[model samples]
Target chain A: MAKYLLLKHYRGAPAAVNDVPMDQWTPEEISAHVQYMNDFAARLEGTGEFVDAQALAPEGRWVRYDGEGRPPVTDGPFAETKDLIAGWMVIDVDSYERAVELAGELSAAPGAGGKPIHEWLEVRPFLTAPPTITE
Target chain B: MDEALLRSLTPSVLGILVRRGADFAAAEDAVQDALVEAVRVWPADPPRDPKGWLVTVAWRRFLDATRADAARRRREDLVDEEPAPGPAPAVDDTLQLYFLCAHPSLTPSSAVALTLRAVGGLTTRQIAQAYLVPEATMAQRISRAKRTVSGVRFDQPGDVATVLRVLYLVFNEGYSGDVDLAAEAIRLTRQLAAAIDHPEVAGLLALMLLHHARRATRTAPDGSLVPLAEQDRGRWDTASIAEGVEILQAALARDRLGEFQAQAAIAALHADAPTAEETDWVQIVEWYDELVRLTDSPVVRLNRAVAVGEADGPRAGLAALAALDDSLPRHAAVAAYLHERDGDLATAARLYAEAARKAPNLAERDHLTRQAARLNARRCR
Candidate 1:
């Protein structure tokens, strides 16, 4: 099976309000989006297909190793990565085409406007290892 | 065949498929398919030679699919005859598989998942449970990893360190999934050490044994983490300890010291101690110093600080901690411990809570939270 990384984050995963910003969405629409996502995650969890899901904090900093004399310093994660990852899921499936299919489903997870966020999801495949008896 | 038998024969069957010119990724997929079919067919008519049967069926399935696929037509043409009929591939194939799985390009988590599925014959769900992730996520990771490595020619040799790390993680997991991950890791590592002359391979085995010997006592009677100091020394496996120590001593005598060997030495010291008070904190610190020289990992330095604390005093440890990066995980927790030791309960409690909030895994978070709660209770009392 081909694997795909389903990137998750406020901007990465489906956020219900792709057309309108989350702040612009009505309160009822926001609640509906939240309910939709919760139900979607639960449904995926019920299936064996759900590999992993996480939500990371928005606060992040860039770092570099410093020279012997100079101390290391922290820089903000401010390099215009609008779709920064808060979390991700790695799923193993039958084919790359199938991975795309699943990603589409995940992308459809609700956003703030009570419609499919269809947010930008980064799909990455895992590198394979040695053979198994089953393969 | 039973699950135990399935696991035992998995590597051999995988080796056979690889020998028959199935690339590593394709062979793994075919073998998994055969195992599933076996689970379905075996209960009714169990094969006398399970390995032979699995290799035969999986190979056929591989051929059928390869022939059907437009992209793999060139590789499929290399298979002179579709149905593979042969004795198992040499032990060398098995060793090669280990190297392939541990390729440096793959992440440690992906490597572990691939090895467990291919070498250990574990199900995707089983692997997911052990790591506390959903099966789909793990399955995707494994598949993506396979596709990435599919381009790497099987004939080319790869870095052994990657393989060692994967095997090390497997051993360290201590049997969370359907398969006994620790045992599978040992079996695979033993296979690796036999094929390669690397001293660290021996060191890894020794490390596994040293830590594994006390695995029986790692958990408390209530199933929580029992710190090494609180462990019942009597429950330790003396035989495993002896074997580990012997291997470690042999490796050390060679004077080709490596990180694994240094870590094993530290574990060996812990095993040698009859009581927490009698622990050779000074020697352990010395080993940690060697480790820092070999690998400048911030985590190693963090640990060394603890050893420094034990060898000298909590104040010394705190000073060392202050020199470290503030972003390292468990930094706050270690600070809390050192602070508590220095009679700074308020600071310790606050740091402990902060550490608990930052904890990655649930068990660790719970344990840290408990530590904070216990301190709060004591303060009130």
Candidate 2:
């Protein structure tokens, strides 16, 4: 069965975690964490099972594209909202257990504080519509 | 060219294809292909034991296709692939096929397709026409479903819930043309109930019988929806209602209250009423409460609100509707119905129009739109 990721914050949510000063961590540690996440994603990509994945920007702004010229918009750091989502990935995995294992690995990616925040992510199954039968 | 003989042998042909290592999906397709050929050729020379003749023909077609598929590791490749047994395989062939068709990984649509084709003994064209979808799209869906579950071990006995869900989908298709898919679903579910003695199975059969018992009265002579309060109770099938009540009582006595049992309870209450005014809405609401606890589905919640409205009043029903997510598919429709009951005709008309826009089928769209028109006409009058 295919699986989905409900990427979200772990400790007191994203805003609380983002409040930690980034300057305190060694630059090399940050680079290592980034590289680790990229490599893990790359490995997943090797299998045809890696359907989709992407990290969403921490900040989001609402805009009205309905206007003619440069649609009206709003400002950013994007206030910490309750039940806000970062982003999600849809992956084709053989079982629920395997999806959990992959999510755990992603959660372990080191943050700017040089410690794995291991954000608590909720996993949900995607209910697909019935297939259209062709003649 | 004997139509009666061909109909009789359809299940046997299906059995032979399944035994010859074709999965429920492939077996269904191959048997359908053979049956079509039989219809075209058999009238001229009806064979003795026509079922045996069909079995031989369909098995060959199944074998031919299995070998031709390059991507799939042919079942023929399996060293121990069992040869077709003589006419009338000792094993319960139909049950085995039913288990495979209702395999867990397959989506409800694919499972329904597999079961109808394999168990209902239908042609792909019949299924395609029945659902009003392009045959190609359905074929691909079924193929993809079959491929996805290819690795799933076929020998293992399957879950009953999956099987029940498949049959329920069949029943819900609702008769559009001459097919009478609802009747077909009842037939198939009956077969399934007989095959397995699950309380829920019996409960589902009762539920279908009770609902079908009122299907005629659900629509008025003008083909508009006849709300339950206005339905002709005399038109309801007394025989079916009795059978449903008897079966439901038996199921309830078991003390195993599954989702079907809860649904059947509500149906039984409805069946007991001689007139809508006399309906045991309190008992119906209690069953809905049980149904919600068992399966916290938005649809069930919507239904509960209806019963609550019936038992208490419209305002209470609207209050229940308010707490649920507005995004649910039937939320607007249910809200409209409640508003109409509460005498807010303008709001009811607006909501009904909105609901008609979202109705899944054209029939539902026309029905809801007509409701809006009638209310608007009443206001002008």
Best by TM-score: 1
Q: Which portions of model 1 miss their true places by more than 4 Å?
A: A1-135, B1-6, B37-53, B67-84, B89-91, B132-136, B173-175
**What tens-digit string does per-residue lDDT give for candidate 1 at B252-344?**
999999999999999999999999889999999999999999998899999988888888999999999999997997899889988898889
lDDT of 2 by residue, B124-206 (tens): 66775675544554465556666766676655787888888777777764346556777787777777777678899998899
DockQ of 1: 0.08
| Regions of model 2 farther than 4 Å from truth | A1-135, B1-16, B20-29, B40-50, B60-87, B343-350, B373-381
Question: How high a TM-score does candidate 2 get?
Answer: 0.65
In CAPRI terms, where does candidate 2 land?
incorrect
How far residue B245's Cα lies from its native spot in candidate 1, in Å, is: 1.7
Give the Å error, residue B249, model 2.
Answer: 2.4
TM-score of each: 0.71, 0.65
